[model samples]
Target: MPHIIYNINASPTSDAGVYPIILSGANGANYRFEYEAANLIINKAPLSGIINNCNRIYGEYNPSFSMSFTGLKNNELSPIWTKQPRFITYADKYSSVGVYPVSVSDYDAKNYTIDTIEDGTRTITPRKLVLKVNDSDRLYYQDNPTFTYTSTGFVNGDDISVLNKTPEFSTDATIYSNVGMYAVEIFGAEARNYDISYIPGNLIVNKRVLKVVADNKTRRYMTDNPVLTYTIAGFINNETENILLKRPIAQTNATILSDCGEYIIKILGAEAENYDFEYITGLLTITKIDQVIQWKQTFENIHIGDQIELLATADSGLPIEYIISGNVEEYKSGDRTYIDCLGCGEVSIRATQEGSVNYNPAMRVVKYFTISEDASIDNINSDDYSLNIYTKDGYVVNGSLSQQYIEVYDVSGNCKYHGTDKKIHVGKGIVIVRVNGRSYKLVCK
Candidate 1:
């Protein structure tokens, strides 16, 4: 073997690098054999280490860590790691204060054996929390309302459910407390992952509200005034209208002699402790009494030359005046307010009483009386030539119908007219007039 020569003089080193190798024979002085070449490769030596444990406060990000190398072989230098191992944990910043497993992922360890990869631990500590309370108000003698608060510093979607016990609020104020400010306090809250703190608030006690009202009353003319009264509204705590330091006084400017109108009944001078009073006025109605005339007389069936006394009275104790009409005469003599009816034929008298300042006007009274039926138609002789019989009562008809022969009779069954004439004279009282087949009773004015 011609110079089974080799380039194997030196041994490989523990360092990592590439060295070239050539094995070939010198060309036997003339022709050289094809050279054989090869390369020697040295890789990095393996290393070992243990992952370090980490700690983090609750509601914070996970902290970074380092590794502890066990040793190196052949006194080799530690290799430069391109990628380091990673630690994984199920615990988050929001996790409760405790120890949690921190396992390591090799990442090939860059040829490093990560001993006790699962031996890592992450210790989480408590987070800071602030509970700030809200202010409130209440009226005097009122029950306290429920209090509330707001919190800061929660992490990883954690809320009040993360707390073992919620904070409770309280106050020294009571239903019997005076109208002034009171202290509101907070206490009793617990959570494993938090160190809680507080911001205090207050509650204000205010005065209560109430109203005083006057009662309305009414009175008639020439009558006594009614008693003025008052009522109270919005009383609390078993309080009544009698609890006022100065009770309301109700008054009005109305009297018996007042005209028919509305007057204000005012409520004034009301006082109470811890209560704001509002006064409300009422109405006082002064009205007039009704006055009426009393006359009862059905004067009927009397002969001529009859003399009758017209008598009537008034409810107002006032004298009644009488007016006579038709074929009657009236005479009022001296201070006596009496009407004398002396005449024949049909007569009517009206009695009236004018109203005074204390009384309303009386409705007039009237009565009709027939002394006798004068059958003599002296007034109709001049009007009989007219086509229509226009009597004192009214016009009878628009036009006459077929077989329209008219007859007139007096109340005493005396035939005044039996001729076929639609025109006739009706004097007074009630009379029957036959037109066609119908009979109508008419009264002359």
Candidate 2:
């Protein structure tokens, strides 16, 4: 058996190669017993490593970096590091959010070259930003106001001026829009340092005030009422009456047959979405009509007994009342008037009409006629005028004629008609009529 005296041990920091064993004394009888053939062999170690990705907020600094190694020979296999690896990234607190390359500086694994199967890297990520739009309002048919917004989470105390691209605000409303609700949208905002979130807002519209007034008018009695009208005020944004949902209505109680008086004209029933309405009233006046009486002053050609008509009319279409001045026979109620002159004397008639609510009173009017005895009433045998004769239209009677007196009697001296009348009405029988002292016989048939 060949016996060895000194030994050789493998260390983690030892170089991998063939080495000679240490010998202070040799036990070989033969001085050169295989001294060149006894040697220890070491193999090269396989190694691998990786650098991790990283992230952070926009306002924060970069965190520390690390690397993980794989495929070491064993737990007992440890490599001595001559120099450690150094890592660096382009991302910083104020840097834009994007993929940035991570690089390496100096790295070593003892005397052996380290085969880095995976490359090391440092990653940068975007921070959060809050953006919001402000609410706004305006009246109907008015121009739009300026829009604005508020922003938060800007890094380094930066404002909207630091943003490379900014969003815009818009709404569904316009200057000519009516009263309603509309949406406001925020869109298309961009910045290098942060991710954005938009908060929506609202646009409001209010109603406007409007005034309406009724018009005044006038008319006469028995006339038609005028057409009602009104006036409007306070319109905006080049608006017209055509924009109204329902037009205003004017009203009154007067008609063509209404009496003479004052009436109230009112305004109401107006409608519109964007308006507040106020109403006003007006007045209508009616006046009385003038009136006159058409009549004559005097009549002609009078006799002892006669029947005549009193003709009189009023322009107001009212009835005429006949007033007699002396003793005369008259009929009161009818469209026509008749009077009887019983005796020879002067007679007079007056006509008048009282006023009503829609007409003025007519003026008073009068007319007269004279009565006389006839000269042909006497016989031609003597030319003397005597007290025993009474004259009528064609002849003379036996008695004198009084202005209001006439009489008729029966043959037995019974008086039938004792009133003032141009004609006598009696029962059927043999009857005697007496005019003054003269007598006439009538037969019943």
Candidate 3:
């Protein structure tokens, strides 16, 4: 072995005194050594005390409350307090009403265990004040009014005058001159004994009583221009004493014309400073200068010798006069008119009404119809006069048929058959046939 080495360390100690250290080394053989260390000193552990006395804090008035502690020596440790219920760091000033605990601890932290002192609870209280105003009296236009109120914790002798504060209404008569609701408030009044809180009050101003009377009138169509008139009473000021109220401005959407209907005449923006005005609404009735009417009818698939009656209807639910002209003759009985289809042509019937007191001249509407025979055959002479017909059941041929073109139509003018064969099949109906410019009608039974 080259050389022997030894290392040593001592455990941490709280007490100060002399102590011994032993060392051992080995180099092929065991050896031991001893030494004494001196002058080791350990300071005393920090001590903490309990706080027993605490001052009551007025959260509103005071900034902080002082505390007293016991069992602490020489100011060796500083007091660090905690607020209880919540157990947070203590604050100097208190703002809310509650009981809080404060704990004291040493400023110097030691490795050894230490004790802390918890103090008794500190109490905080709140102070509040409120003010209110009384405004139960009703006010009228052009009248001056006074106001009063009740209070809590605020005395009348505290040099407090409501007029010195910001008031919603003063003694001026103009404050109550309008017909509306008003709030009278007195705020920011300072008092010596207690805090002042403000609550607003209401004042209602009434206007002079008034009424509007309107007259009912009628207008004739395109003939008369009706003027809207009204009467006003209870005028309170010289501005309207001898003044005549003009007709109200008409609304943009209002229609007054000869269309024979009820119309509304509204008085817009009618007001007087000292007088309470009422909205005026009026009605005007209009009558037509002449009777007006309309008629509707559909003419389809009319046959010759068809006797048709024409009846005209009007929106006014009045009788309509009928006039017939064309290929048809009209027969009148009572209020009804009949038309006899004379031939295969077009005929027109018109509806009309003479002028009446409640209506303008009647507007006329005409209806037309075309008449035709059901089916008729015209004889044709052909060398190949061979004719063949086919019913829905089967085919039938008369004589020897030739290769001639054939076309057939229904009574409603719809083509039913077309071909070049002698025998053609068809459904059961009244059909018109044309072969090589000759025409015939077949009633398929």
For every candidate in turn, the CA RMSD to the true structure comes to 12.1, 14.3, 21.6
Residue 159 local lDDT, model 1: 84
The estimated TM-scores of all candidates read 0.47, 0.42, 0.30
Model 1 TM-score relative to the real fold: 0.47
* Model 3 stretches astray by more than 4 angstroms: 1-133, 136-139, 142-148, 154-170, 174-214, 237-247, 250-257, 274-277, 290-328, 331-445
Find the 10 residues in a row with the least total lDDT in model 1.
375-384
* lDDT by residue for model 3 (193-245), tens: 34457787766677675666555567776556466676666655444534434
Q: How far is candidate 1 from the true structure (C-alpha RMSD, Å)?
A: 12.1
User: Per-residue alpha-carbon lDDT of model 1 for 108-209, expressed as tens digits?
Assistant: 534344444335788898888888878889898989878888889887788888889999888889998877888788878898888899888888888787
- lDDT score, candidate 2, position 305: 38
Q: Which pairs clash in the backbone of model 2? A: 390-397
Which ranges of candidate 1 are over 4 A from the true structure? 1-63, 66-79, 88-90, 99-121, 130-139, 148-161, 178-183, 199-211, 220-227, 238-257, 261-282, 289-445
lDDT against the true structure, each candidate: 0.68, 0.67, 0.53
lDDT, model 1: 0.68
